[model samples]
Target: MAWNLDSQRPIYAQIIERVQYDIVSGHYNPGDKLPSVRELACEASVNPNTMQKALSELEQSGLVYSQRTTGRFITKDTSCIRKIREELAKQQVLEMIRRMKQLGFTKEETLTLMDKIYEEATYEHTIGV
Candidate 1:
């Protein structure tokens, strides 16, 4: 995970978002064991306690779970992961629209431009660009 902390939010919350993005983007697979708290702390350059707090929140969100005498793993619930992925995608799209509106684009213009860009990207992907 590329950890970047912003002044706008808590470090642990940023950590949680990074982990969630990793899981949804397949950087971390379902049932995969995450790095130890100390390891993740080193990776994110934060204190161990902060990483632990972020992991605890992930557990509460059903994105991860810890086993006795073992360690934490990404949840095996594919449905939950899929739901989260869709939610994040929608958030991205809405943000894009919001920015375009602030730049004076109408709703139809924003969506049409989005569709055109997606089609071009899809074509490139299909051709192994």
Candidate 2:
């Protein structure tokens, strides 16, 4: 995994987001083992403590669980994965809406754009594009 350290967000927060994205994207599937904090920190060139904190936050969020000696693994619950996906989708939509508002888009225009997006996404899914 590559770290974009120059991003506006804090490194730890970006690390958490990257891990979450990996989970959601199936790069780290349910019940799959995750790299140790030290390993991940080395890979990302981040502090071990920061990586640990991010993993701890994931544990707190129920996206991952720790087992004695075996280390941490992704959650096996499908509902938990679905919940994470829903929450991420809601966050992305809220951010997009906020940006639109800042750009002076009217509510009706935002809704129309969202409808168009939905149609495009549906078409993409239908055509496997």
Candidate 3:
């Protein structure tokens, strides 16, 4: 999953985003120890230095922490994780609204479309889509 990177953006930034998503989404739970930098680099097919930079950035952001002679672990702060989750959701919503406006849809129309889509999606999920 970490290998799904693109050339349009910085690889380390992408790695940070992926790791953050993993943490917030519960793929890596609170206090879970992370794999070694070399291991993550191997998994992402990136240079170890790139993975280190990403992890360091995440550490500075308080999402990850390290102990002496021990590996990095996900932060145990559920509130911080929740805040990050909301921030990510808001980013997606903002981008969706931006695209809708670009397509000439007003706020009301966008909301209506969203409602319809949500209903259809809910129905599909109920039916085991």
RMSD of each: 2.5, 2.8, 1.9
lDDT by residue (1-129, candidate 2, tens digit) is: 467675576788888888888899899999999999999999999999989999999999999999999999999997999898888899998998899999999999999987898789888886444
Which sections of candidate 1 miss by over 4 Å?
Answer: 121-129
Q: Give the worst 10-residue stretch by lDDT in candidate 3.
A: 120-129
What pairs collide in candidate 2? none
Residue pairs that clash (backbone atoms under 3 angstroms), model 1: none
Q: Candidate 1 on 47-128: residue-level lDDT in tens? A: 8998999999999999999998799999999999998899889989888888998999998898788789878988889534
> lDDT of candidate 2 vs native?
0.90
Clashes in each model (backbone N, CA, C under 3 Å)? 0, 0, 0
Q: Can you give the lDDT of residue 66 in candidate 1?
A: 98
Candidate 2: 10-residue stretch with minimal lDDT: 1-10
Residue pairs clashing in model 3 are none
What is candidate 3's local distance difference test score? Answer: 0.92
The top-ranked prediction according to lDDT is 3
The candidate with the higher lDDT, 2 or 3, is 3
The lDDT values for all models are 0.90, 0.90, 0.92
Q: Per-prediction TM-score, please?
A: 0.88, 0.84, 0.94
